[model samples]
Target: MTKCLGLVAVLAALGFATQASANQDVQTLASDPANWAIQSGDYSGHRYSKLDQINASNVGDLRVAWTFSTGVLRGHEGGPLVIGDVMYLVTPFPNVVMALDLAHEQKILWKYQPKQDPFAAAVMCCDTVDRGVQYAEGKILVHTADTSLIALDAKTGMEIWKVKEDDPKNGASGTGAPLVVKDKVIVGVSGGEFGVRCYITAYDLNSGHRVWRAYSMGPDADMLIDPDKTTSLGKPVGKDSSLKTWNGDQWKIGGGPVWGYMAFDPALNLVYYGSGNPSTWNPVQRAGPGGKRIDQKWSQTIFARDADTGIAKWVYQMTPFDEWDYDGVNEPILTDLDIDGVKRKALTHFDRNGFGYTLDRVTGELLVAEKFEPDVNWATKVVTDKSDPQYGRPLINKKFSPFETGTDDVTKGICPSSMGAKNQQPAAYSPLTSLFYVPVTRLCMDMEAFKVSYQVGQPYVGATLTMFPAPGENGNTGAFIAWDGAKGKTVWSKPERFAVWSGALTTAGGIVFYGTLEGYLKAVDQKTGKELFKFKTPSGIVGNPMTYMHDGKQYVAVLSGVGGWAGIGLAAGLTDPEDGSGAVGGFASLSSYTGLGGTLTVFALP
Candidate 1:
């Protein structure tokens, strides 16, 4: 099971590596607003659309325009890829890719399913999930559950070229979507819970050639970091940047499975992504001599790298010596914000650590970091201004620090839980409203960490915990809120009885749409958190909402199937409410609300 293929894709750090030569066709298609040409819809990672035919004023009149079933009953995360008259969709394990003829009443034009090892699904930390696909250079890029990155002809669904990015034997899997940076397809894997060293690799988009691969933690050459030129918080990080902080070779199995969404800046020639958490959730096991915190270098960090060379420009580590398994791998929404009368290129992120951070994307300067959830108690506040010596660090509350309490000390009343304030359910940024619509979990946990050894292809997690709704907000488990990243403040909040595990989508129509675990797709006013429309889908939803223009009409689409970490109990047919560690124990009520289902429900005005 210990397949040493060499990688270090640790969790959510928002590293930067974007379009090198600029795929002109994808650039034009994404710019036209007629097609969702990329996995994140655009490089900005806004998850927002310009189509407004179905505005808030008439969204109530919207009806089901079309629907298609993937025939796979598992969690559906990302939305479909609608490029012109063709639409592309992917499913959970044994990854299946289907090209649908949008003009021909949603006819199945072609389908390609990979024959994968069943063991891949068996070893996943949570449940099997593939975040759809990405499109570039007339090819559909697929990151399969078995760690295979393949390219299929967009029109025929025929295999163009394929590469084994990582071996499943080592517990490596690719759940997040691959990103196309010009001619290079950048990919990251998820297996942090399996205790595998992780990294991001860039392959040529057309030829499937390995361009450059960078590890999350290790030697400077291995990470492609320039000791003198590469920086941390605007200062150069000298040689042995990663090795110095780690205790011996512990960084080798230190999980860096960065399986989250990525963003790019064409002008900066940078690719952005977040790395995963360190391995062995028990901080006591990862401690240095004399019980000092092991600052596992590069894990739980955000990075900006030169797209072509894959060298780090700058990096900022959040949740250093992480004790709560807070991965830095959230979606980094890039936008230009005028802060203090100065227009700055900004990247805003809603972290699993329960903080909304906005940083200067160009220089990696810390701009704003504030708790989106008021009840978040792990940290008091982040020092935002560079003037302070403690800038960019969260002031930890020792009362909730698992590492502080040591091994076997059951830490109670930790807000946000290890599920974080949010999961992969991405938020949306609307320029019109200048706000971020976030769909998030509102649960607290009681956790106990024990020493655990790293075993490849097996869960290396050392924490066992149970979850319940957080205190305040009437004991609700989820909420949809509007946030102003520029000011690091919440604009409004709307509570949900269950977790809002679905992604949010905002449109020029002035509405933000998100789905609830109860199967209700709710469209609300963008400015205010007022509900505008709600429709029940066939099952609970964990998919992101997307919009596209077809035949001069605007349409919105989302996939409904409940089987992510939050719905693993029903999807995996597990009777134990405590299965998946505590996932079932936390979200066991979801089984009573909806059963397993897999269907794409598209909405449009009649």
Candidate 2:
């Protein structure tokens, strides 16, 4: 049951070897704009397609082509994977994978239902939404809600191999998508709020053999940190970086969850990912300078590791001594840009700390950091070394710091609330316009930190927060903005009544597509941010949008449901007026607009 080695042998004995097709290769995935071969649409994490069949010039004529209801309604967060003429979709909770024949009016070719444990529902920190699945070597790789990593045949719904990746009993689950690199299938664990010391593991794609595992905490050996070699900002981390930063083996339970997206550069042979916040939001309990340090080292940090060996190559801490739970787990989007005339390989990320960063992906050097949201007050600005100028660090304004409220006191009037200017939703980058399309919410929070004791299988969170929109924002809750990453500024923004919770999709057609929390799917001009088209769906959308070419026509598709931390109060009808914090009451307005829905909607030109 726990990543069985013999099960793979049995599968191999049954002639379950992966079948490779010409289009399944990595080169085809990088160049083919008609097929979404991998999650994030070809690994650059651009979420942009080159198919210009649905251009902005005639976008107003777009119409719904077909729809499929998942039947089980809940929060849906990820989009589908389209390969050849088949589109693969994964649902929430039960973690069902359905193969839709695109050429035949979206016929359901096959469906795979794994044996999922019901207890996983209680362990998930957010709604029961699986990000998505990956397709490689003729196999469909899925990470279930119950911590299981499975591979199924693409042509059929046959199970090839299954491995238990996380322990739900220990407050660990798997909601993230699997990333396949060549013959290795990489997956990360979730549950930072449960005091889970997270990790990333790789398995053989052909046979489910566990390769190497790397932890986010513990000693240097466990973290795979070669201090003398692992550099950050052009300097070495020395030795025992992870252990020296913790107090008395506290690193064992120190939370640094990996619940978000990851990117890889085959040329650099490094995989990029960001670690989540430390356990127990109460800084009084988790903060300790064990060795000569003054705070936790790696919590809320970004790491670059050798893809094959799982060894740390470079790391950069975004929030040192994190007191506000601004998770550094946002997607590290990789791209190349011309900065001040020099073209450099950059990793663009919209951090929860309210800053959009452009870093040198090769050496982990910070290039530019600026606010994407105007209401950010947790930090004055992101500054760099006085001598080097390139070694940037956040100049946290203590006047607005959450710690100013005292150890056991409540902090009020913090801008860009605990949900952050952005959360788990991913942004997109278009090579045609060279602009990053970002989905963000504008809000502030009132937080109160309390002491908490660590207990297995129980919540380790020690803070309660009440979130509401920022002051004087004209009652607008969210906006989809086109960001100029090179200039570190916003190009244009489209305001919405609710937070834009869905991922964006930009096409060569000069159109950007996104969904709103109030259930409206809209398309706008990629250049001017002018509304080109809008349609009301059945429910709020938290999933990402995707596009594919089938029958020589481009189709846009997205999953819609009314569930996530943002809409939890609505979907569950949780009207806890006297809740510990006023968060439930503050967000109760969402229910009035939209409720629960789980359906896959596809649109195309008639």
Candidate 3:
């Protein structure tokens, strides 16, 4: 009897040890400081982590623990969200929602698939993929490809409610990530190429009810006569308003799609977003009736609108009557910069026009506008007060022809291609290093503009753009630039053969995480741009990197699949048609890896 009692006591002690270990795993995920709210670390849009367990010194020792492939194919740009011990991610095409249980060895808890329309593929100008989903109010909000917004229960992945935000007949969809502020889910409509007028809408989190809507172009009342009267914001002054800049109802069909990332400041109660370029490749098609020439306002502008009311607080137009396809749809990063001796809350954006701009978030004042590239000929310098550059204006010479706009010429190479310095990829702002890490494509384009007219359902304009090596540069690839926002200078840079399609993420450990078009996930020093670590995934990594703590370990996660615009172009050139029969030249390669599908891989320290 004594021996039996002693054995029972030993078994009880072992049971207590197992329970303690289980509790420790939960604590690691719950108390992790690196995983926080929103994109980056907070509302500031700084994608910097405060955890040092995976610092630059120890990053070299990192290894992959697991990978989750959705097999959805197409482009994989969705960045995953880590909350508690669960991981949430979005897939391409139909924009499926997935939840994974981290404590149970990264097992998928549930998957929510949205009903997508097959005809929607024909309207998508680029690839059919979403950047990511937003987590707010105990629910995961995902914008579907069918123009519907669905809310999922965070724990069960069950549909809480689904709301259709746009008319399917108008060719409107949601490809960009949804931004959640308090109870409002702010989202924008995409499908500019299909002649759809764009708009931004906000919805309630609890009820999935729309709060307010703001159109990119003014209504018929404002476009024809008084511009201010058409919009929610009152009229503009004299000739400065966008209405006076245009001629006779041309503003009615002007395109300014808000198909990019948005940032918000709770302190100021402002949600800022950048607008896309005008419709059609040709300005002649959008020019005023009878021969009147007018400059369209707000097409390529950064607007700061009230979060709750959808009222325009201030707008800084980057390119006023933009003849080039220079869409200002890049991510707008919010930060506080020390300009001269004054500390100002500034908004930083690396525009597609090859210029990096710093503006006062509160007043929309241009703080610093400088060219980050060497061969930016379109603009000599950005005006401090106004957003216009010093160079690149259209000249109306009859010799140019009715078919050709004077600005479009193959010989007169554009400084930055339509891809610009940075495209849709998100940049990282590290508060620890006081720097912004940007992945820039160092390439130029030979552009010949053509006269374009807006018709109901046909191609409106024509321009030929051929990618070339940067001026005095030999390669046609990309570079990782460490920009010091405080000093407005390039601290360090690393070049590559292919553009860095993936966005960047910085950690408190002084390491920056990003992926390359060549299928390598890399970790670099935030200050020196030194390559500390790298891991090759299934395919090229185009998505952003995110970090989360699970089971007492820090895990790094990213998606790997090749199907975006750049990926399709590169694959067409690299893969021979003979090698793969029945493959179309340009975007045909996008379907090659379509079967390989999309994947979300996670890594942890062993």
Candidate 4:
């Protein structure tokens, strides 16, 4: 007994349980494709694995290896994490964390499920989705729907440290996964519709001490922005940047919720993320200059900030004076590309505003900006000329603009519903194919703008919308497309009956995998976008698909649960055809196909 005790103590002293030695372990594991270490797979947010054991030719032979039930309802947005011989899974609300031993007959090694107030679900905007979990060193990180971030022992499932990040009762909750960057874990808050000010906070990984908190929109100090240092369009953003954009203390509730995938660049020591839509979705209520560009400074913008100090490096506003509720909370994929005979570092982003943008991740230079959806008509194009005073702003078509049409008027046939061309479903970039596999929502809407007064922690949205499939596209509502980010072109597209809500996975096998709202896990040719193999899941899949290798066999896994905006119309019995408050009545057709469920399916070549 004395000898065993000393051995355990020696192991702990040798980079076993301490947080200071955690970064190197995570970095090494993340560098490996055999283990899906982080939420984005790697810091680049590529979601592409380098394992080629299950190639495109053999992917069609994939059979069910095993399955597990999360036993929770609502949407599951993120995927699972696999490290060594264990698989970690997290649920939606009560946020149950399960560590399953893969070596054995998939035994439950340990489970960590929290008990909390059921009323915490009220603060959630949509389907009460938890993006998933993160693992680093020997700890599993979880962000709960009730505004809590927890770290647990990877081996024993014991609580290492837990912190209350926000007040769910006060209308601020975090649904996305927390990202671990070196010695810190970063989290972004969500409350755009609740009129609550949002920010991204980073904490010390070891002691759970708050390191920095940067607001989405506020004064320079609160935002942690350097007046003459942080820049846009290659020029300094002067003082009062966010303050001058709003009227009076409106910036207090300025809704720039950074509640989505954030990618980091270790070489540059910068982290990149986008903010959500501004408060009071009604354009008329958020007053601005009529003919000029309303610089809602950081909302609907991409921000590159110093990971350690939380100082803004640069920013690019995707939508200036956004009249539509296009939250710019999608992932920014980092990679190097040769653009127009010049080899440059590129950061590609698919915005909720129906445009795919590629910029220099290092310098924040706009290299390519084009409409991934051919029918997108919100704005003709993004102005990319740096010299133009109108640079980085969209050339709006006033006919579809709610702001231009004035209050109480309904704007008709605005392509790309407030959901944008896509929501938080992440796109996968294959460095092998030089193409991005994107899951698209071909949705459009008719929005009516009105007046609304903001009250503390209350819903401040002032718009009513009715959604439908984009016109002239048969009756299909979604598609899987292969895009060339350097050229801003779609190489191939395959239409889907419903929105392709799952996150995409592209492996060295040359196959792109994603799930459909009809409960099918599909594999398509990475080169041609041809459906090669597909299997019906237990329910509609809104979660991301992930790939990992254990015991020399490649395994692909995905979570299936139908409760996002597209399926919530059925899950919650919402009957209004024009309902657009998170539950889209346009997707009522899903009632005939799927219902509420939560299951994880794994596949491997037989």
lDDT of each: 0.87, 0.83, 0.70, 0.87
TM-score of every prediction relative to native: 0.96, 0.93, 0.85, 0.95
Model 2: what TM-score?
Answer: 0.93
In model 4, the clashing pairs are none
Candidate 1 clash total?
36
Q: How accurate is candidate 1 locally (lDDT)?
A: 0.87
For model 2, the superposed segments whose C-alpha errors exceed 4 Å read: 1-26, 289-293, 385-391, 577-583
lDDT for 126 in candidate 4 is: 77
lDDT of 3 by residue, 97-215 (tens): 88888779778899988877776654565567788887775788888776788888988988899899775456666788888775688888876655566778889878988888876
For candidate 3, the lDDT comes to 0.70
Off by over 4 Å in 3: 1-37, 219-240, 288-293, 385-411, 451-461, 570-597
Candidate 3 clashing pairs?
40-47, 49-508, 73-597, 228-235, 285-452, 408-449
Q: Report the lDDT tens digits of candidate 1 across residue range 1-606.
A: 223322212211233323334666677788878788876778889988888898989999889998999999988888799988999999988779999999988999999999788888877777788887998878999999888999999989899999998888998988989988878999988889988899999999889999999999999999999999998888888898988888888888989778889998887878899998998888889888788976788998898989899999999888888889889998899999988789999999999999998889988898889999887999999988688898888899999989888788899999888888988889999999889999989888888999888777788999888888888768679999999998889999999988899999888899999998878888999998889999999999999888899989999899999888888887898867557767787887787789889999999999
**Candidate 1, 59: how far from true, in Å?**
0.4
> How accurate locally is residue 253 in candidate 3, as Cα lDDT from 0 to 100?
61
Off-target runs (Cα >4 Å) in candidate 1 are: 1-20
lDDT per residue as tens, model 4, 1-606: 999999878866653543333367777898888899988888889999999998878888999999999888778779899998999989888789999999997899999987666877777777778898888778899988777889999999999999998887777877988999888999999988888789999988887899999998889999999999998877889998998898778778788888899998776778999999988798777776554446677898899989889999998889877889899989999998989999987899998888999999888889889999887998999888878887777899988999878889889899898878988899999988899989999989888888888776577889888888898889898999999999999999999999888889999889999999989999999999999999999899999999999999999999999877677775556788865473456786887887888999999999
